[model samples]
Target chain A: MESQQATQVVLASRPATARASLENFRVETTPLPVPGAGQVLLRVDTLSLDPYMRGRMNDARSYAKPAGIGEPMPGESVATVLESHSAEFVPGDVVLAQTGWRSHVAMDAAGLKKLDVDGIEASAYLGVLGMPGFTAWSGLEVIGKPKAGETLVVGAATGPVGSLVGQLAKLAGLRAVGIAGGPKKCAYLIDVLGFDAAIDHRSPNFAQELEAACPNGIDVYFENIGGAVWNAVLPLLNQYARVPVCGLMVQQSGTLQHDTSADYLAATMRAVLTRSLQIRGYINYEFTEQYFDSFLREVGTFLREGKIKHLEDVTVGLENAPQALLNMIDGRNFGKVLVQVRSNASASRS
Target chain B: MESQQATQVVLASRPATARASLENFRVETTPLPVPGAGQVLLRVDTLSLDPYMRGRMNDARSYAKPAGIGEPMPGESVATVLESHSAEFVPGDVVLAQTGWRSHVAMDAAGLKKLDVDGIEASAYLGVLGMPGFTAWSGLEVIGKPKAGETLVVGAATGPVGSLVGQLAKLAGLRAVGIAGGPKKCAYLIDVLGFDAAIDHRSPNFAQELEAACPNGIDVYFENIGGAVWNAVLPLLNQYARVPVCGLMVQQSGTLQHDTSADYLAATMRAVLTRSLQIRGYINYEFTEQYFDSFLREVGTFLREGKIKHLEDVTVGLENAPQALLNMIDGRNFGKVLVQVRSNASASRS
Candidate 1:
């Protein structure tokens, strides 16, 4: 924190295809922004890197608006309130804001969410206690509707959302089977997160392994990466299986080769009709007003008791935020990807 | 009525492909068996030809088991009880039975459901007042969950299930849009069925016309024919759209060429996630124990008051049952396809 200037990463150009590259982002520095009346000057601490950012790079219709060229890539981050012109927050207070990839931002106090920082790190809100955590909770309870005896299969098992989904399903008395890219995440899902079983999606016999892990057939599928993994889950889905489609990481991530065979739709429709499947897609905010309070109460208790465990994959600087996001999209980054702009944990604890 | 023999249409062979042909069924004759203890002799009067029966012909696992080769093709029909061996029923009673394509068969009294036939035709138990009617009701109310001022689109809009779906949507205060083949059925959908708009699926500009029809975007799509029609409905669907996949007529019918371009699934999955869509598949029977009585009460009243109307495409005699089913699957039938095995409207009206 020696410079009087603020650093930010902006969208340099839109990706020509679903796959995004480092060339699409640019880093620049400007004079530190001053807080206006009823606003606070925030110094970014931890920036959340999500796969959804890839969708924002394209000029496609999504729940949120696409990031414009020369505009800071949209994101949520934990920041320290350096200077406040409002009664709600004080200097050195940690708050959450949609300040994108900026090292510092002048934001209205009305939009900032203050953190409790009660034993847990302030950055925990951006991962486990924030949007990713909320997404997993809402999608599982509202759409997936897993029953105690049922089996639930979630993709991206080591990522923030899928990890929470598996742990929650296990807590709800379901047989949780997770699908991850490697043996390490797979082992972590079972050994660390208490998942009943975990299958490496990259295995040559992935489908057979998934089926073997879920001997009772999948009752709920928490869909994040939709591609070969979705196809594998389709046939094994039990009658009236519920699929809560929260993300399509494989679709947005340009690394996976597009399978040209389209009869996949026919097979999907067949399974849907024959097995009476329920596939519902949703975003977290849709359930905020309806279930957020309950979510906070329940997940907060679970977090405090150590019933749920989470992981964070942090990059070191604001300039490298773009690479962190790209890495997350390509599944090269593990856990909840984040960019640590400033590492002063004392600011929140004090 | 003088014959002492029973006639049956058995599955001669399973279709090698999705398209079933007349050769797959064979008509056979056997000596009529006397009613056994606790069984009654049922004379088939009206056999309901449903799209689901086409699924039973192939050796594919569906809601019902695959029809055994050389065994009678499974179906439900309105029948007349000729002899009773139990106190539960007597002769001259109208009943519903799963006797398939048969002129006469002995059924257990426990399985035979005695029909009132108070004002409506006993055949109505096979169409507007029966499974077709119930299918539309349960799918729309339970799964579709349409709200007032919302747009509801249905394929096969002039048939029994689709007609009732559109009428029910109209009655529920929705903008009902129908997708049918040719100008005749399209006109009938708007003029007689009271659909807010009707688009001819046969038109070269079908997608454009459909988009124009649903300016508000589709909220409930009663998916019966899932092919190009489904493709057309995908983009037009609004956020939180509900699709109750009752039948995939196009896939089973095999009249429409399989679109070799397979990007349809990607488009479907993308829309499902971006728009937060809900696509569910179900059979009417799943809701039978829960909502059947309510369905009969509401739809029965609508039928009597003329608030709802239905059409019966009848092919006389038991031998033509094969063609009746084929006609339905191929979209040649104009309305509710039924095989009138006996000309005895007087049996119920008396």
Candidate 2:
């Protein structure tokens, strides 16, 4: 595939605000290079488009480095090994790689994790068993420190991390109250995800709805989105409530500027004071060193036993990567969104 | 004293915003009555003027009750028992009570803690040996968990809580950086309080000053004033920073808001995610049931040993109580402001 080239999206410019157009990114066809002595050539199969990517596009200090201008956007992708000079992998083995927004790329063998797609689809590695799942698992288990009778409230409830958070809360004997944008996600949260209560944030009476849903104020609020959703959830948090904040996708849309009035600081501090709340911010990678083993074993077992259900909105081909990512950023993606870079025709039959 | 009525201040109306004025209070000269079956007739000696009273002045729900209309303002006071009908206390005994702003009050013996002055002034019970000091101690020791070699940054550095926080951080072998308004308070923090670094929040380059002071990013930020000071300090916060928010006195002055700009929240969230920052709000009362004994023993000893220094700005009479409290809310009080309602000429001396 070296002569045929690799497809990747690179940052063309920085976004000024929430209304950033797709013109900020450009797709480039580059020559795929041969693997080095300890490297493997990955044929990208599924790419995970996450909300955190919005933070990477801006030239600001965050948990990770911003995607530099003219760099391949950072992401996680499930790939198949097309060629391997490393002893660790075979040519036809399926793997997960950091080769982002691409059809084919060469990377160190150490960077890839070998995958088993037994009963689950290969794309499941990008959703249920991948970064999002681990992010939710680690944040909830470690920082949240949820107890059996405690109530756990999570926003973006239908998304990969949030869906698992609500379900995991229930599995741990905590009341799970899921907050989602629309009725559809709310319905799915109750019927499919088995959340104790689901509130539609789209409703005008969202604050009241959330209060009604959580008669016993929330003990742990898994803060994935921080905007009006946070405003609605803050008052309902119980004393000593633990908020493990992992994502702020809801604030990416410039709504934070509009929503955060002059009293926003005072209001937030008041809530902090009254509730004695613990609002912790975490990135999945920081906890990975300590939590990866437990997460891998427990999540793997849960997936195998059909205890945790995962959903994905898969898009085909490398050409549609930009729009797929855009759709995901706009919250249009129903679950984890992935791109099918190259079809594994035989894997479906196997 | 019973024949001559005692003066009492009552809450006339609730404040909407920064509109809280002395006009919202009314002083009534009511006839003093004898103590009930299990109560004591106490002469108020000192009243604590804390910034948190601003919250109580408003009708909003908080950690404590709002001072109701026509009801004497709720407060913590060191009073001398003039008449006792309860088996727990005798006449002329100095005790602490949660009575409102009154020259004399009829109180239950169960609602009071006996004062142990020892080598400390009885007035210190309303400041360093009381709630303010306990607040700093509990938050720093329990929530901030100041580890040796870590840097602790406290805003409103010269206040009762912040002053003690800086000193306690020092005692724990942690570097203490204090942020206070003006050159004088900054000087007091370094000279009198013995903080490792003291920066004036009033400086034009306050953020830069804080950055230069804390070469190692802040680990424990005792958030007392959450406005511009917080914005300046937020960027300097290191990963795993424990922010034990005590009060937002600066914000209560009806000043600046949190930097809710998308970029700011994005940056804050990124820092939190990357560093695993833990921001927990706390009230000293929560720890009283757990740490009161150790606190009373340790802090009590520190005061006797001259290890902890305390400052107070006393407003002479009961008539000056409103202005004293108002000044405290406005950050004009140099230290703990006490209203001497009655003299303790014949009380047991330390």
Candidate 1: misplaced stretches above 4 Å? Answer: A1-45, A52-74, A79-94, A100-106, A316-331, A341-349, B1-45, B51-74, B79-94, B99-108, B114-119, B316-331, B341-349
- Alpha-carbon shift of residue A148 in model 2 (angstroms): 5.1
Question: What is model 1's DockQ versus the real complex?
Answer: 0.60
lDDT of 1 by residue, A192-279 (tens): 9999999997798988999999889999999988888888888899999999998887775543434657688888988899889999
Please, what are the lDDT tens digits per residue for candidate 2 over residues A1-350?
A: 23367788888898888645689889898888678899998888788887778878888986589998998888888888889999999988998888877778989999789987776677777777778888899889988989999999998889899999988899899999998877888999999989988988778888898899888888999998786787777778889888899887655555533264444555666788767888888778887788887887888888889998888788887677778877877768898888777755633633
How many clashes does the backbone of model 1 have? Answer: 1
Cα TM-score per model: 0.85, 0.75
What are the DockQ scores of the candidates, in order?
0.60, 0.37
Report lDDT (Cα) of residue A112, candidate 2. Answer: 82
Error of 1 at A91 (Å): 6.3
Candidate 1 residue lDDT tens string, B61-178: 6546899999998899988888899899987899999998888899889998888677677888898889989999999999999899999999989988999999999999999999
Worst 10 residues of 2 chain A by lDDT: A255-264
As for candidate 2, its clashing pairs are none
